[model samples]
Target: MSDAAAYACDNVSTPVEAVQAVLARDDLTPAQKQEIAQGFSARGLEFDVSEQVCVDQG
Candidate 1:
C-alpha cells in the first residue's frame, strides 16, 4: 500500500473519518483533496458537510 493509504487505514475506521482526516491535513494540495473526495463518492460513502464542520470545530 502507498504511505497515504497506510496512514488512512491506521487512523480512520470509516470513509467519512478518512475524509475528515484528509481535510485536516496541511500537507495535501487541492487536487489531492479532490481525489480523496472523489474516491469516497465512488465507494458510495456519504457524509454530511455540517457534521464535518462540527468535527472540525470540536
Candidate 2:
C-alpha cells in the first residue's frame, strides 16, 4: 500500500511510528519486515505495505 495508507492503517505518523506499526503486525515475514525497517532507516521514503490503494470514485 501507499505510505500514507500504511500509516493510516495503524493511525501513525513519522517513520518511527511506521516502524512501530510494522513490528506489531503478524502477517509479514521477518525479511519483509526488515526491508520495511530499512526503508524507514532514512528519510524520504514511502512504505510498501502491498495492500490495494483506495482510489476516489469522484
Candidate 3:
C-alpha cells in the first residue's frame, strides 16, 4: 500500500484528521501532499495549514 493510502486508512477518521495526518508526514513530496489535499477537497474537506486555528487572547 502507498504511504498516503496507509496513512489515510490507519490515521484518518475525519476530514481534518486526514489533512493533519498528511501534513505531518515527512515521507511525502510536495506533489504528493497536493494530491492528497486535492483528494480531500474533492470530498468536501478543505485544509490550509497557513490558517491559524488558535490565537492568543491575552
Q: What's the CA error at residue 7 for candidate 2, in Å? A: 20
lDDT of 1 by residue, 1-58 (tens): 9999889776556756667887667787766766666666644355332223235555
Question: Cα lDDT for residue 24, model 3?
Answer: 69
Clashing pairs in 3: none
Clashing pairs in model 1?
A: none
- What TM-score does candidate 1 get on C-alpha atoms? 0.44
- RMSD (Cα, Å) for all candidates, in order, is 9.7, 15.2, 9.4
Backbone clashes, each candidate: 0, 2, 0
**What are the TM-scores, per candidate, against the unseen true structure?**
0.44, 0.43, 0.46
Ranking by TM-score: 3, 1, 2
Tens digits of per-residue lDDT for model 2, 1-58: 9988887656545556757787568788767877876667655545544443478999
By lDDT, rank the candidates, best first: 3, 2, 1
Write down the lDDT of every candidate, Cα atoms only.
Answer: 0.62, 0.66, 0.66
Summarize candidate 3's per-residue lDDT along 1-58 as a digit string, tens digits: 9999888776556757757877768787766776776666745357543322577899
Better lDDT candidate (1, 2): 2
lDDT of 2 at 11: 50
Candidate 3 has a TM-score of: 0.46
Comparison by lDDT, 2 against 3, better one: 3
